[model samples]
Target: MAESVKAPKTVKVASTAGSAAGSGAAKAASKKKVKGGVINVAVMTLAAGLIATMAIPAYAFNPQGADAAQFKASAIDGMKKAQSQSVEVPETVAASAVARDAASATTEEQLAAAKAAEAARQRAAVSLASYASSYSGPSVSDFLANPPYPNFSLDQVFSVAQQYIGTPYVFGGSTPAGFDCSGYIMFVYAQFGISLPHSVSGQAALGKRISIEDAVPGDVVIMPGHDGFYAGNGNIMDAPDTGRSISIRPIWTSNYYIVRLGI
Candidate 1:
Protein backbone atom coordinates (compact mmCIF):
# COMPACT_ATOMS: atom_id res chain seq x y z
CA MET A 1 0.00 0.00 0.00
CA ALA A 2 3.04 2.11 0.35
CA GLU A 3 4.02 3.44 -3.12
CA SER A 4 6.65 6.27 -2.68
CA VAL A 5 6.13 9.04 -5.23
CA LYS A 6 9.31 9.66 -7.23
CA ALA A 7 10.08 13.48 -7.75
CA PRO A 8 10.95 14.72 -11.23
CA LYS A 9 14.65 15.76 -11.47
CA THR A 10 13.99 18.16 -14.41
CA VAL A 11 11.43 20.19 -12.47
CA LYS A 12 13.84 20.80 -9.62
CA VAL A 13 16.58 21.97 -12.07
CA ALA A 14 14.17 24.41 -13.85
CA SER A 15 13.13 26.02 -10.58
CA THR A 16 16.80 26.61 -9.59
CA ALA A 17 17.58 28.16 -13.02
CA GLY A 18 14.74 30.76 -12.74
CA SER A 19 15.92 31.95 -9.30
CA ALA A 20 19.51 32.54 -10.57
CA ALA A 21 18.31 34.73 -13.55
CA GLY A 22 16.29 37.07 -11.26
CA SER A 23 19.28 37.71 -8.92
CA GLY A 24 21.63 38.60 -11.88
CA ALA A 25 19.17 41.26 -13.26
CA ALA A 26 18.90 43.03 -9.88
CA LYS A 27 22.73 43.29 -9.48
CA ALA A 28 23.19 44.78 -13.03
CA ALA A 29 20.58 47.53 -12.32
CA SER A 30 22.35 48.58 -9.08
CA LYS A 31 25.75 48.81 -10.87
CA LYS A 32 24.27 51.12 -13.58
CA LYS A 33 22.85 53.55 -10.98
CA VAL A 34 26.22 53.84 -9.17
CA LYS A 35 28.07 54.54 -12.46
CA GLY A 36 25.76 57.46 -13.28
CA GLY A 37 26.32 59.06 -9.82
CA VAL A 38 30.14 58.86 -10.19
CA ILE A 39 29.97 60.54 -13.63
CA ASN A 40 27.91 63.53 -12.21
CA VAL A 41 30.41 64.13 -9.32
CA ALA A 42 33.40 64.27 -11.77
CA VAL A 43 31.71 66.91 -13.95
CA MET A 44 30.98 69.19 -10.96
CA THR A 45 34.63 69.03 -9.76
CA LEU A 46 35.99 70.06 -13.26
CA ALA A 47 33.61 73.11 -13.48
CA ALA A 48 34.60 74.38 -10.01
CA GLY A 49 38.33 74.23 -10.87
CA LEU A 50 37.85 76.22 -14.15
CA ILE A 51 35.88 79.04 -12.42
CA ALA A 52 38.50 79.53 -9.64
CA THR A 53 41.40 79.80 -12.14
CA MET A 54 39.74 82.63 -14.18
CA ALA A 55 38.49 84.79 -11.21
CA ILE A 56 41.71 84.92 -9.10
CA PRO A 57 44.01 86.51 -11.75
CA ALA A 58 41.38 89.09 -12.80
CA TYR A 59 41.06 90.50 -9.29
CA ALA A 60 44.83 90.94 -8.71
CA PHE A 61 45.44 93.00 -11.93
CA ASN A 62 42.53 95.53 -11.45
CA PRO A 63 43.00 98.68 -9.29
CA GLN A 64 39.85 97.83 -7.34
CA GLY A 65 41.33 94.76 -5.74
CA ALA A 66 39.31 91.87 -4.41
CA ASP A 67 40.65 92.66 -0.93
CA ALA A 68 39.90 96.10 0.60
CA ALA A 69 43.26 96.44 2.44
CA GLN A 70 45.40 95.93 -0.71
CA PHE A 71 43.54 98.64 -2.66
CA LYS A 72 44.01 101.25 0.10
CA ALA A 73 47.74 100.66 0.39
CA SER A 74 48.22 100.99 -3.39
CA ALA A 75 46.34 104.32 -3.51
CA ILE A 76 48.34 105.86 -0.65
CA ASP A 77 51.66 104.93 -2.26
CA GLY A 78 50.73 106.73 -5.52
CA MET A 79 49.66 109.97 -3.79
CA LYS A 80 52.86 110.25 -1.71
CA LYS A 81 55.04 110.27 -4.85
CA ALA A 82 52.96 112.99 -6.60
CA GLN A 83 53.00 115.58 -3.77
CA SER A 84 56.77 115.52 -3.18
CA GLN A 85 57.64 118.77 -5.02
CA SER A 86 55.22 121.44 -3.73
CA VAL A 87 56.72 124.94 -3.00
CA GLU A 88 56.18 127.20 0.04
CA VAL A 89 54.33 130.57 0.03
CA PRO A 90 56.73 133.44 -0.92
CA GLU A 91 57.56 136.81 0.84
CA THR A 92 56.09 138.88 -2.06
CA VAL A 93 52.71 138.15 -0.52
CA ALA A 94 53.53 140.87 2.03
CA ALA A 95 53.87 143.49 -0.71
CA SER A 96 50.45 142.60 -2.05
CA ALA A 97 48.99 143.25 1.40
CA VAL A 98 50.66 146.69 1.53
CA ALA A 99 49.29 147.66 -1.89
CA ARG A 100 45.80 146.75 -0.78
CA ASP A 101 46.22 149.01 2.25
CA ALA A 102 47.26 151.95 0.04
CA ALA A 103 44.21 151.55 -2.16
CA SER A 104 41.96 151.70 0.92
CA ALA A 105 43.63 154.97 2.04
CA THR A 106 43.14 156.56 -1.38
CA THR A 107 39.43 155.70 -1.30
CA GLU A 108 39.07 157.42 2.08
CA GLU A 109 40.75 160.60 0.77
CA GLN A 110 38.35 160.80 -2.18
CA LEU A 111 35.35 160.45 0.17
CA ALA A 112 36.61 163.29 2.41
CA ALA A 113 37.20 165.61 -0.56
CA ALA A 114 33.70 164.99 -1.87
CA LYS A 115 32.19 165.86 1.55
CA ALA A 116 34.11 169.15 1.83
CA ALA A 117 33.06 170.22 -1.66
CA GLU A 118 29.40 169.57 -0.81
CA ALA A 119 29.66 171.71 2.35
CA ALA A 120 31.20 174.59 0.42
CA ARG A 121 28.35 174.53 -2.09
CA GLN A 122 25.72 174.79 0.67
CA ARG A 123 27.43 177.86 2.23
CA ALA A 124 27.50 179.71 -1.09
CA ALA A 125 23.76 179.17 -1.68
CA VAL A 126 22.92 180.74 1.71
CA SER A 127 25.17 183.82 1.20
CA LEU A 128 23.88 184.52 -2.32
CA ALA A 129 20.24 184.34 -1.22
CA SER A 130 20.88 186.91 1.56
CA TYR A 131 22.65 189.32 -0.77
CA ALA A 132 19.94 189.11 -3.45
CA SER A 133 17.18 189.92 -0.92
CA SER A 134 18.89 193.23 -0.02
CA TYR A 135 19.88 194.31 -3.56
CA SER A 136 18.37 197.32 -5.33
CA GLY A 137 18.50 196.46 -9.05
CA PRO A 138 15.86 194.47 -11.01
CA SER A 139 16.86 190.93 -9.85
CA VAL A 140 20.62 191.36 -10.48
CA SER A 141 20.73 192.89 -13.96
CA ASP A 142 21.62 190.52 -16.80
CA PHE A 143 25.29 191.62 -17.63
CA LEU A 144 25.15 193.25 -21.13
CA ALA A 145 24.78 197.05 -21.16
CA ASN A 146 23.55 197.27 -24.76
CA PRO A 147 22.16 194.07 -26.32
CA PRO A 148 21.98 191.10 -23.87
CA TYR A 149 23.08 187.69 -25.09
CA PRO A 150 19.69 186.10 -25.80
CA ASN A 151 21.39 182.67 -25.87
CA PHE A 152 22.87 182.90 -22.35
CA SER A 153 20.56 182.59 -19.32
CA LEU A 154 21.23 184.47 -16.09
CA ASP A 155 20.39 181.39 -14.04
CA GLN A 156 23.13 179.42 -15.82
CA VAL A 157 25.72 182.13 -15.15
CA PHE A 158 24.65 182.44 -11.48
CA SER A 159 25.10 178.69 -11.10
CA VAL A 160 28.76 179.06 -12.10
CA ALA A 161 29.19 182.08 -9.82
CA GLN A 162 27.98 180.30 -6.66
CA GLN A 163 30.99 177.97 -6.60
CA TYR A 164 33.41 180.73 -5.58
CA ILE A 165 31.59 182.65 -2.83
CA GLY A 166 34.09 182.73 0.09
CA THR A 167 36.73 180.51 -1.48
CA PRO A 168 40.21 182.05 -1.05
CA TYR A 169 41.71 182.97 -4.41
CA VAL A 170 45.06 181.30 -5.15
CA PHE A 171 47.50 182.46 -7.82
CA GLY A 172 47.59 179.35 -10.00
CA GLY A 173 44.87 177.46 -8.15
CA SER A 174 41.79 176.03 -9.85
CA THR A 175 40.30 174.60 -6.65
CA PRO A 176 38.44 176.08 -3.67
CA ALA A 177 41.56 177.54 -2.03
CA GLY A 178 42.73 179.48 -5.08
CA PHE A 179 42.29 180.18 -8.79
CA ASP A 180 43.86 181.77 -11.88
CA CYS A 181 41.82 183.31 -14.73
CA SER A 182 41.53 179.99 -16.55
CA GLY A 183 41.37 178.10 -13.25
CA TYR A 184 38.46 180.24 -12.07
CA ILE A 185 36.56 179.64 -15.27
CA MET A 186 37.37 175.95 -15.17
CA PHE A 187 36.32 175.54 -11.54
CA VAL A 188 33.10 177.61 -11.65
CA TYR A 189 31.59 176.11 -14.80
CA ALA A 190 32.58 172.62 -13.60
CA GLN A 191 30.24 173.07 -10.63
CA PHE A 192 27.40 173.99 -13.00
CA GLY A 193 27.76 170.66 -14.90
CA ILE A 194 29.68 172.48 -17.65
CA SER A 195 33.13 171.07 -18.39
CA LEU A 196 35.30 173.95 -19.65
CA PRO A 197 38.83 173.86 -21.01
CA HIS A 198 41.66 174.65 -18.56
CA SER A 199 42.55 178.06 -20.06
CA VAL A 200 40.55 181.26 -20.80
CA SER A 201 41.31 181.01 -24.51
CA GLY A 202 40.03 177.44 -24.55
CA GLN A 203 36.91 178.53 -22.60
CA ALA A 204 36.16 181.16 -25.26
CA ALA A 205 34.99 178.33 -27.57
CA LEU A 206 32.50 176.81 -25.01
CA GLY A 207 29.02 177.94 -26.15
CA LYS A 208 28.04 180.57 -28.76
CA ARG A 209 30.56 183.42 -29.13
CA ILE A 210 29.11 186.94 -28.80
CA SER A 211 30.08 190.62 -28.21
CA ILE A 212 29.98 192.43 -24.86
CA GLU A 213 26.70 194.11 -25.86
CA ASP A 214 25.13 190.72 -26.56
CA ALA A 215 26.49 189.05 -23.34
CA VAL A 216 23.99 187.88 -20.70
CA PRO A 217 24.47 187.18 -16.96
CA GLY A 218 25.54 183.56 -17.48
CA ASP A 219 27.63 184.34 -20.56
CA VAL A 220 31.40 183.90 -20.33
CA VAL A 221 32.80 187.33 -21.25
CA ILE A 222 36.30 186.98 -22.64
CA MET A 223 38.85 189.72 -23.29
CA PRO A 224 41.82 189.77 -25.67
CA GLY A 225 43.55 191.46 -22.70
CA HIS A 226 41.88 189.41 -19.89
CA ASP A 227 38.95 187.02 -19.25
CA GLY A 228 36.03 186.80 -16.72
CA PHE A 229 32.37 185.80 -16.35
CA TYR A 230 29.80 188.61 -16.78
CA ALA A 231 28.20 189.33 -13.34
CA GLY A 232 25.73 191.98 -14.56
CA ASN A 233 26.04 195.76 -13.86
CA GLY A 234 29.11 196.08 -16.12
CA ASN A 235 30.87 193.92 -13.53
CA ILE A 236 32.89 190.76 -14.33
CA MET A 237 34.19 188.15 -11.87
CA ASP A 238 37.59 186.65 -12.56
CA ALA A 239 40.51 184.95 -10.82
CA PRO A 240 42.75 187.59 -12.37
CA ASP A 241 46.51 186.94 -12.82
CA THR A 242 48.96 185.64 -10.13
CA GLY A 243 48.68 188.56 -7.64
CA ARG A 244 44.92 189.34 -7.70
CA SER A 245 42.27 187.15 -6.07
CA ILE A 246 38.95 186.20 -7.63
CA SER A 247 37.15 189.60 -7.69
CA ILE A 248 34.82 191.78 -9.77
CA ARG A 249 36.32 193.54 -12.79
CA PRO A 250 34.89 195.79 -15.56
CA ILE A 251 33.50 194.23 -18.77
CA TRP A 252 33.77 197.66 -20.55
CA THR A 253 37.24 196.72 -21.75
CA SER A 254 38.09 197.86 -25.31
CA ASN A 255 38.83 194.35 -26.52
CA TYR A 256 36.75 191.41 -25.15
CA TYR A 257 35.15 188.19 -26.38
CA ILE A 258 31.86 186.70 -25.16
CA VAL A 259 30.81 183.03 -25.19
CA ARG A 260 27.63 181.27 -24.03
CA LEU A 261 27.88 177.65 -22.79
CA GLY A 262 24.43 176.26 -23.34
CA ILE A 263 22.38 174.57 -26.03
Candidate 2:
Protein backbone atom coordinates (compact mmCIF):
# COMPACT_ATOMS: atom_id res chain seq x y z
CA MET A 1 0.00 0.00 0.00
CA ALA A 2 1.17 3.54 -0.70
CA GLU A 3 1.94 5.63 2.36
CA SER A 4 -0.40 8.51 3.40
CA VAL A 5 1.43 11.83 2.90
CA LYS A 6 0.82 14.59 5.48
CA ALA A 7 0.31 18.21 4.34
CA PRO A 8 2.46 20.87 6.03
CA LYS A 9 0.55 23.26 8.38
CA THR A 10 0.34 26.91 7.29
CA VAL A 11 0.91 29.35 10.19
CA LYS A 12 -0.44 32.94 10.27
CA VAL A 13 2.15 35.49 11.43
CA ALA A 14 1.35 38.94 13.02
CA SER A 15 2.77 42.10 11.22
CA THR A 16 5.22 43.66 13.93
CA ALA A 17 4.84 47.07 12.42
CA GLY A 18 6.15 50.08 14.66
CA SER A 19 2.64 50.90 16.24
CA ALA A 20 -1.10 50.41 15.56
CA ALA A 21 -1.60 54.06 14.42
CA GLY A 22 1.90 54.60 13.03
CA SER A 23 1.24 55.56 9.38
CA GLY A 24 -0.51 54.47 6.22
CA ALA A 25 2.73 52.76 4.98
CA ALA A 26 2.75 50.49 7.97
CA LYS A 27 -0.85 49.33 7.46
CA ALA A 28 -0.16 48.61 3.77
CA ALA A 29 2.83 46.40 4.68
CA SER A 30 0.61 44.42 7.14
CA LYS A 31 -2.09 43.84 4.49
CA LYS A 32 0.58 42.67 1.99
CA LYS A 33 1.94 40.05 4.38
CA VAL A 34 -1.64 38.72 5.05
CA LYS A 35 -2.19 38.14 1.30
CA GLY A 36 1.15 36.25 1.11
CA GLY A 37 0.02 33.89 3.91
CA VAL A 38 -3.32 33.17 2.13
CA ILE A 39 -1.45 32.40 -1.11
CA ASN A 40 0.85 29.91 0.71
CA VAL A 41 -2.21 28.17 2.27
CA ALA A 42 -3.81 27.78 -1.19
CA VAL A 43 -0.62 26.27 -2.66
CA MET A 44 -0.30 23.79 0.21
CA THR A 45 -4.03 22.71 -0.09
CA LEU A 46 -3.61 21.96 -3.84
CA ALA A 47 -0.42 19.90 -3.23
CA ALA A 48 -2.19 17.83 -0.51
CA GLY A 49 -5.17 17.05 -2.78
CA LEU A 50 -2.73 15.87 -5.55
CA ILE A 51 -0.87 13.55 -3.15
CA ALA A 52 -4.13 11.97 -1.85
CA THR A 53 -5.36 11.27 -5.42
CA MET A 54 -2.14 9.30 -6.24
CA ALA A 55 -1.95 7.46 -2.87
CA ILE A 56 -5.63 6.22 -2.53
CA PRO A 57 -6.54 2.88 -4.12
CA ALA A 58 -9.35 2.67 -6.68
CA TYR A 59 -10.93 -0.19 -4.57
CA ALA A 60 -11.19 2.16 -1.61
CA PHE A 61 -13.66 4.27 -3.64
CA ASN A 62 -15.48 2.33 -6.46
CA PRO A 63 -14.34 -1.30 -6.24
CA GLN A 64 -14.32 -3.85 -9.13
CA GLY A 65 -14.41 -7.72 -9.07
CA ALA A 66 -11.17 -8.22 -11.00
CA ASP A 67 -8.46 -6.26 -12.79
CA ALA A 68 -8.29 -6.42 -16.64
CA ALA A 69 -4.90 -8.21 -16.75
CA GLN A 70 -5.98 -10.95 -14.33
CA PHE A 71 -9.20 -11.58 -16.22
CA LYS A 72 -7.32 -11.92 -19.55
CA ALA A 73 -4.83 -14.40 -18.12
CA SER A 74 -7.63 -16.57 -16.62
CA ALA A 75 -9.50 -16.67 -19.94
CA ILE A 76 -6.35 -17.60 -21.90
CA ASP A 77 -5.53 -20.48 -19.52
CA GLY A 78 -9.05 -21.96 -19.70
CA MET A 79 -8.96 -21.92 -23.52
CA LYS A 80 -5.58 -23.72 -23.56
CA LYS A 81 -6.85 -26.45 -21.23
CA ALA A 82 -9.99 -27.00 -23.37
CA GLN A 83 -7.88 -27.26 -26.55
CA SER A 84 -5.65 -29.90 -25.00
CA GLN A 85 -8.65 -31.99 -23.89
CA SER A 86 -10.37 -31.87 -27.31
CA VAL A 87 -7.64 -33.99 -28.96
CA GLU A 88 -7.62 -36.77 -26.32
CA VAL A 89 -10.12 -39.59 -25.69
CA PRO A 90 -11.15 -40.96 -22.29
CA GLU A 91 -9.91 -44.51 -21.55
CA THR A 92 -13.43 -45.80 -20.89
CA VAL A 93 -14.67 -44.62 -24.30
CA ALA A 94 -11.72 -46.22 -26.07
CA ALA A 95 -12.34 -49.53 -24.28
CA SER A 96 -16.03 -49.51 -25.23
CA ALA A 97 -15.10 -49.08 -28.92
CA VAL A 98 -12.74 -52.06 -28.73
CA ALA A 99 -15.44 -54.18 -27.13
CA ARG A 100 -17.83 -53.38 -29.95
CA ASP A 101 -15.18 -54.42 -32.52
CA ALA A 102 -14.56 -57.72 -30.73
CA ALA A 103 -18.29 -58.47 -30.59
CA SER A 104 -18.61 -57.80 -34.32
CA ALA A 105 -15.73 -60.21 -35.09
CA THR A 106 -17.33 -62.97 -32.98
CA THR A 107 -20.68 -62.55 -34.73
CA GLU A 108 -18.97 -62.85 -38.12
CA GLU A 109 -17.25 -66.08 -37.05
CA GLN A 110 -20.54 -67.62 -35.86
CA LEU A 111 -22.21 -66.69 -39.14
CA ALA A 112 -19.38 -68.38 -41.06
CA ALA A 113 -19.68 -71.55 -38.98
CA ALA A 114 -23.43 -71.69 -39.54
CA LYS A 115 -22.92 -71.34 -43.29
CA ALA A 116 -20.38 -74.19 -43.30
CA ALA A 117 -22.72 -76.51 -41.37
CA GLU A 118 -25.55 -75.78 -43.86
CA ALA A 119 -23.26 -76.49 -46.80
CA ALA A 120 -22.24 -79.84 -45.32
CA ARG A 121 -25.88 -80.84 -44.77
CA GLN A 122 -26.73 -80.05 -48.42
CA ARG A 123 -23.86 -82.12 -49.79
CA ALA A 124 -24.95 -85.09 -47.68
CA ALA A 125 -28.47 -84.83 -49.10
CA VAL A 126 -27.10 -84.85 -52.63
CA SER A 127 -25.00 -87.95 -52.04
CA LEU A 128 -28.00 -89.82 -50.62
CA ALA A 129 -30.22 -88.83 -53.55
CA SER A 130 -27.72 -90.30 -55.99
CA TYR A 131 -28.01 -93.76 -54.34
CA ALA A 132 -31.74 -93.84 -53.42
CA SER A 133 -33.03 -95.56 -56.55
CA SER A 134 -30.10 -97.91 -57.27
CA TYR A 135 -30.95 -100.87 -55.02
CA SER A 136 -33.61 -103.54 -55.80
CA GLY A 137 -34.32 -105.50 -52.60
CA PRO A 138 -37.18 -107.12 -50.68
CA SER A 139 -40.17 -104.90 -49.88
CA VAL A 140 -41.28 -104.03 -46.32
CA SER A 141 -44.24 -106.44 -46.83
CA ASP A 142 -41.90 -109.47 -46.57
CA PHE A 143 -40.76 -108.86 -42.95
CA LEU A 144 -44.06 -107.34 -41.71
CA ALA A 145 -46.35 -110.16 -42.92
CA ASN A 146 -48.78 -110.17 -39.93
CA PRO A 147 -49.09 -106.35 -39.62
CA PRO A 148 -51.58 -104.13 -41.50
CA TYR A 149 -49.03 -101.64 -42.88
CA PRO A 150 -48.12 -100.20 -46.29
CA ASN A 151 -45.64 -102.13 -48.52
CA PHE A 152 -42.79 -99.64 -48.80
CA SER A 153 -39.72 -100.97 -50.69
CA LEU A 154 -36.50 -101.66 -48.69
CA ASP A 155 -34.32 -100.96 -51.74
CA GLN A 156 -33.36 -97.50 -50.48
CA VAL A 157 -31.72 -98.97 -47.36
CA PHE A 158 -29.52 -101.33 -49.39
CA SER A 159 -28.81 -98.74 -52.10
CA VAL A 160 -27.51 -96.22 -49.60
CA ALA A 161 -25.78 -99.07 -47.74
CA GLN A 162 -23.80 -100.26 -50.81
CA GLN A 163 -22.38 -96.80 -51.50
CA TYR A 164 -20.38 -96.95 -48.25
CA ILE A 165 -19.13 -100.53 -48.74
CA GLY A 166 -15.45 -99.65 -48.25
CA THR A 167 -15.81 -96.53 -46.06
CA PRO A 168 -13.52 -96.80 -42.99
CA TYR A 169 -15.08 -97.18 -39.56
CA VAL A 170 -14.88 -93.99 -37.58
CA PHE A 171 -15.99 -93.72 -33.97
CA GLY A 172 -18.88 -91.25 -33.53
CA GLY A 173 -18.78 -90.47 -37.28
CA SER A 174 -21.82 -90.66 -39.58
CA THR A 175 -20.48 -89.29 -42.90
CA PRO A 176 -20.21 -91.41 -46.07
CA ALA A 177 -16.37 -91.42 -45.97
CA GLY A 178 -16.29 -93.00 -42.47
CA PHE A 179 -18.73 -94.30 -39.82
CA ASP A 180 -19.20 -96.46 -36.72
CA CYS A 181 -21.61 -99.41 -36.90
CA SER A 182 -24.58 -97.50 -35.51
CA GLY A 183 -23.48 -94.35 -37.29
CA TYR A 184 -23.64 -96.22 -40.58
CA ILE A 185 -27.11 -97.54 -39.74
CA MET A 186 -28.41 -94.09 -38.80
CA PHE A 187 -26.89 -92.50 -41.90
CA VAL A 188 -28.57 -94.93 -44.30
CA TYR A 189 -31.99 -94.73 -42.56
CA ALA A 190 -31.81 -90.95 -42.48
CA GLN A 191 -32.03 -90.94 -46.30
CA PHE A 192 -35.39 -92.67 -46.05
CA GLY A 193 -36.55 -89.92 -43.66
CA ILE A 194 -35.89 -91.88 -40.47
CA SER A 195 -34.33 -90.02 -37.55
CA LEU A 196 -32.19 -92.22 -35.26
CA PRO A 197 -30.12 -91.33 -32.25
CA HIS A 198 -26.34 -91.97 -32.41
CA SER A 199 -26.30 -94.84 -29.90
CA VAL A 200 -26.22 -98.67 -30.20
CA SER A 201 -28.85 -99.37 -27.54
CA GLY A 202 -30.86 -96.45 -28.88
CA GLN A 203 -31.00 -98.12 -32.34
CA ALA A 204 -32.18 -101.48 -30.88
CA ALA A 205 -35.34 -99.81 -29.54
CA LEU A 206 -36.34 -97.97 -32.77
CA GLY A 207 -38.04 -100.79 -34.79
CA LYS A 208 -40.44 -103.77 -34.68
CA ARG A 209 -39.01 -106.93 -33.06
CA ILE A 210 -38.30 -109.89 -35.38
CA SER A 211 -36.70 -113.24 -34.41
CA ILE A 212 -33.45 -114.04 -36.22
CA GLU A 213 -35.21 -117.25 -37.51
CA ASP A 214 -37.73 -115.05 -39.41
CA ALA A 215 -35.38 -112.15 -40.28
CA VAL A 216 -35.38 -110.64 -43.80
CA PRO A 217 -33.79 -107.70 -45.59
CA GLY A 218 -34.10 -104.25 -43.86
CA ASP A 219 -34.07 -105.76 -40.34
CA VAL A 220 -31.79 -104.33 -37.66
CA VAL A 221 -29.48 -107.07 -36.24
CA ILE A 222 -28.37 -105.81 -32.81
CA MET A 223 -25.56 -107.54 -30.83
CA PRO A 224 -24.01 -106.69 -27.41
CA GLY A 225 -22.81 -103.20 -28.52
CA HIS A 226 -22.94 -103.51 -32.30
CA ASP A 227 -25.61 -103.53 -35.05
CA GLY A 228 -26.01 -103.80 -38.85
CA PHE A 229 -28.59 -103.82 -41.67
CA TYR A 230 -29.84 -107.33 -42.52
CA ALA A 231 -28.93 -108.28 -46.13
CA GLY A 232 -30.93 -111.27 -47.48
CA ASN A 233 -29.32 -114.78 -47.23
CA GLY A 234 -27.95 -114.04 -43.70
CA ASN A 235 -25.50 -111.35 -44.85
CA ILE A 236 -25.11 -107.98 -43.00
CA MET A 237 -23.81 -104.70 -44.41
CA ASP A 238 -22.15 -102.67 -41.65
CA ALA A 239 -19.21 -100.56 -40.47
CA PRO A 240 -17.67 -103.00 -37.90
CA ASP A 241 -15.55 -100.64 -35.77
CA THR A 242 -12.58 -98.31 -35.84
CA GLY A 243 -9.95 -99.54 -38.38
CA ARG A 244 -12.40 -101.72 -40.42
CA SER A 245 -14.32 -101.40 -43.70
CA ILE A 246 -18.09 -101.51 -44.19
CA SER A 247 -19.01 -104.71 -46.16
CA ILE A 248 -21.69 -107.27 -46.92
CA ARG A 249 -20.45 -110.00 -44.57
CA PRO A 250 -22.08 -112.99 -42.81
CA ILE A 251 -23.80 -112.58 -39.45
CA TRP A 252 -20.78 -113.02 -37.07
CA THR A 253 -22.85 -113.87 -33.97
CA SER A 254 -26.06 -115.81 -33.08
CA ASN A 255 -26.19 -113.84 -29.79
CA TYR A 256 -28.20 -111.19 -31.67
CA TYR A 257 -31.80 -110.08 -32.05
CA ILE A 258 -33.56 -108.67 -35.17
CA VAL A 259 -35.75 -105.60 -35.46
CA ARG A 260 -37.49 -104.64 -38.69
CA LEU A 261 -36.90 -100.92 -39.43
CA GLY A 262 -40.32 -100.18 -41.00
CA ILE A 263 -43.56 -101.98 -41.75
TM-score of 1: 0.38
The number of the candidate with the highest lDDT is: 2
- What TM-score goes with each of the models? 0.38, 0.42
- Per-prediction RMSD in angstroms? 14.1, 19.1
Candidate 1, residues 78-157, lDDT tens digits: the string is: 55766689777667888889888887775777989999877766654554454445435321112222222344456855
In candidate 2, what residue range of length 10 has the lowest lDDT sum?
Answer: 140-149
Per-residue error (Å), model 1, residue 213? 2.9
Q: After superposition, how far is residue 22 of candidate 1 from its true place, in Å?
A: 99
> Candidates' lDDT values, in order?
0.63, 0.71
Give Cα distance to truth, residue 251, candidate 2, Å. 1.3
Model 2, residue 86: displacement in angstroms? 99
